[model samples]
Target: MNRIMRESRKLRSWEEMKKIILQRGSSGKDVLAPIDEVFGRKFSVIVDEMPPYISLRNGFTGYIADIWQIISSELNVSAEFQKHSFDAGKELIKNGSVDLLITPVIITTTDIDEIDFSIPIVKIWYELFMKSSDDGATSMSYIVTWSRNLWFAFLLTICILTATLWIIVNIRLRLERNRGKTPPAWQTRLDFWRGYRRWAKGPEPENTLKNELVSVSSVGSSFLFVLGALTNQGNCLKLNSPSIRTATLVTLFFGLLMYNAYSSVLISRLAVGRTTLPFPSLESVAEAKTHIICVRRYSFAYVQFKQREEDKELLEKWQGLVNEPPCLNTTSVRDVAAALCYDNTLILETPNIVAKIIEDYNRSNGCDITRLYGHYARATATVLMKKHFRYRHHFNKMYYFFFYFFSFFSMMINAMLHGGKNFERGTRS
Candidate 1:
């Protein structure tokens, strides 16, 4: 507030002081008491210009105004809500110009030493949104069939319906032409109409059924149904039934047992034939016997690769067999994904930077890398905070709350979208 104090503090820029007042900068001390005493009044905090905290009108802004009002009322203080760009908000807090920085701000240990924070207000979960490739390649052309197990099951049903309907139509036409009569049952007529409707409208049952069935069931069930109809009527029966019985108790029992045994073998065979299969172990990928994989340099993945001593030897052994060594190296994640786009055997590398990469890929229409590799690739977003900040406890609480909240909502939305796609895919497959 004064020239002597400003000079003694070695305040560098207006931008820094502005961030300091807002608690946005990571390099400033809390001058709240001093500022309040000197100004003889409560001061304002700097925040972003968007809603949930502060808004213009229209729809709800999630939690901004609520937080501002609560902090002000409880502390017997008032704040001037200054709207600025996200970067400017940080600058304001850095320069000791604002009293607090309140918005959905990420706080980490590195950030604590510079400026104090209140409890974390909110947290976020991230995901990758990719333009799906047919054969795991970058483009769609390489995809021969996009079979979701659910879709396959549905397709099986369509096939059975089509065949049974064909048989009925033949019978009906023959009876009408020769015997000059309708089919014996009305159910048969209904079946005919249903099949006709499907044929006319396309293979899908109808929008209403699609929405209802897909919403209620898991993708796997839908797939089983489709597969059952396409391959054989008995397929669905076996999937739905744990056991079955027949009239010729002894002979029928043996026959059913044999059918079950054969079906198991056939199912395994079908699973093997599909192009999209579970990835082999990192050891296997490292071996480069029949495939290639991209991994980050000096990263946990690279470390793991090294830890698997046998796998390392295998890579060296196979290096001479290929036209060139299959090692693709790059720092940028997008570039690595691009490399994976064209290479059939290559799997791209993903490091522990989930939120940042997910947001980028989603906005950029890049690689679909949502298929996480278990604990091996868990990336966490952390807040960088400064040391000795007065409000660490307050910030941590807010941060944790947001972390869980955003993660839950984000996953829910993803699951909803995933279910729709999975249903259609499962049915076709």
Candidate 2:
């Protein structure tokens, strides 16, 4: 009974000391001395494999690991890293089984209350990843060169010009008739017969003023004339009215402009070999009912999608597709890539991570995957630690220091390279 009482008292005293150390640490005092005496010089870190940020390749090496290394060396402490799934890592941190999680954790409202996050080390945005289409520049390239609205406007312009020309010619004909001008002699039946009898020996009588006026006054003839001018194929019909002549010239100029623009765009598309995607954008993806594959349930991408009120319909569609058979909740990058290449699916992830995956995959397999659509959502990523960690402030400071250092170093290197190129050019000149 006496021994039990003594042990309990010692435990109570140790707890009190830890509380005091935590208070000092929270108050911005140097509490490392107490932490060292009580906890030890080593920490246990848990991490998930997120490429370009925290990867397990070559035994735990990446941006976050490097930062952690710098901080640990500065503080003269050591860490033991263990690989685990993101969910498992979070559970460990919450239960006080781990000191830190070094994966690139996107900051979300739901996680703020459970775990603490360090200063943002990187900015990340979600993008769509899918397999590149095998067919490049499909048969519909010419038709798709101009948008539907542009085509509609072009057709409407043609109709308007045709109507204008027809109205102007009819008004001129009416005025001439009102002025008591008689039709040409060739318009009479006997004269027409005589002209047809002489057609083989002389110029055709259809070119006479009466036939020209008749053709111009007809709506179908006006439409054909306008279309021919637009296509750079001028008609043979003669127009005497100044207004009709002006409208024809305008149609010709507009046709030339539209033709040049269309030709330039088509040539570029064919030259660059732009692969047409099945669904060009997120809205189209939803409309096409393409399944979305994400790393895990409630992942950052999923969370962002859910929180966006504007994409409510998209969110519902995603939920419905994800709940179907052939589950897409995969953690392996290779599996995600395979699913994208094989199935009609799209994966959502950060640009850098997707690029890394493509680079690595292309090294082994052929180039098959590609990034589609633009960024979907932007978020800042940081390392997650246990709530109220004693070394949180210290880690944040060191991380910021190293981040700035590397950025400055990269800028200097680029400047030096550019200066060298300029100097070489001057010397050559």
Candidate 3:
């Protein structure tokens, strides 16, 4: 009872708590030395299997390691940072095996319940990377151009509808019993529109000629609407501007809209049954499940890879090749390559170590294990804490501070790295 009271009292003061923790060997300080030396006792930290940590030569070796050394020296503590798989890291913290967690720690409530954390030492950004050999970088402009293939798709839909409608109209005119009686073209157009409206708003499936004609006419309406919206000609008075040039621009916009609408229909008809970009064939061990490595139950590229039905089918098809995804050999990215079995050639990995990996491989000119498909999922890193830690306030302050600093730098650095005069010089084919 007295010991319990003493422990309660110890937590009341920050210095007393620190002194008590030091005696127990847990230092909340971010440092390089063993935990005992830093806290004046003994302590352990749970870290994810990320490289340059402590196990390998390149493990957390360069600038980051140096920074940790500075922090270690300043705090005068010996800290033992242990590496584990992502899930294992959580388990270690939950089981009270570690006093703190510090590898690219993402702060969250669940994490706080398992382990304590010091001030966030660094910020990590997750990004998508593709092969550099593919001259086009993955950027907003690239995505727009690639997927604006939507315009072509829409145009195709219009063509099929228009042709179907014309055939039906001509057939009905020929079937008319009285040769002298004929519906005007505009009347026929209005009838098509009415049929279209009914077909769209009516039952689940409409199979009659009227429904088919309606569907065709609706397609035309959609083409015109998209064209008008894209060119900003559908709303002229709303775009009223003072400059005489503005009126001229508006007229030009209307002209462009008409051209685009006509051309879209024409192209859709011509390009029927064809696509410019072929579905990349599934070849090589990397494309097969035999060589792909992902952490157990931990989603890496799983979601993104699954999104492509073809990729998912291939994975299922080749699942026989991979008996099981090997336990991630090490958390550090550099060591990760060596752990891959000869049969395994691909590691579904995080987006954050891309630049370093690229630099390393370029410098080595060896086997390449560093290409990414697309973004999988987004999840923030959080620290795990034991129930008694009671250090939520400390972790939150550190997280917010680290988040602000890194986010600012990430934006600035990303812009600088991905954009320049050279980036702007490219022309679309």
Q: Identify the leading candidate in terms of TM-score.
A: 2
The TM-score, computed over Cα atoms with residue i paired to residue i, of candidate 2 is 0.70
Better of 1 and 2 by lDDT: 2
Clashes of each: 73, 0, 34
Model 1: residue 185 alpha-carbon error in angstroms: 73
Candidate 2 error regions (>4 Å): 1-42, 66-78, 106-114, 179-211, 276-284, 290-295, 304-316, 323-328, 362-367, 400-429
TM-scores, one per candidate: 0.31, 0.70, 0.36
For 329-368, candidate 1 gives per-residue lDDT tens digits of 4333444444443333444333323333454343333454
Leading candidate by lDDT: 2
Q: What's model 3's lDDT at 134?
A: 22
Q: Rank by lDDT, descending?
A: 2, 3, 1
User: Higher TM-score: candidate 2 or 3?
Assistant: 2
Cα-based lDDT for every prediction: 0.41, 0.65, 0.43
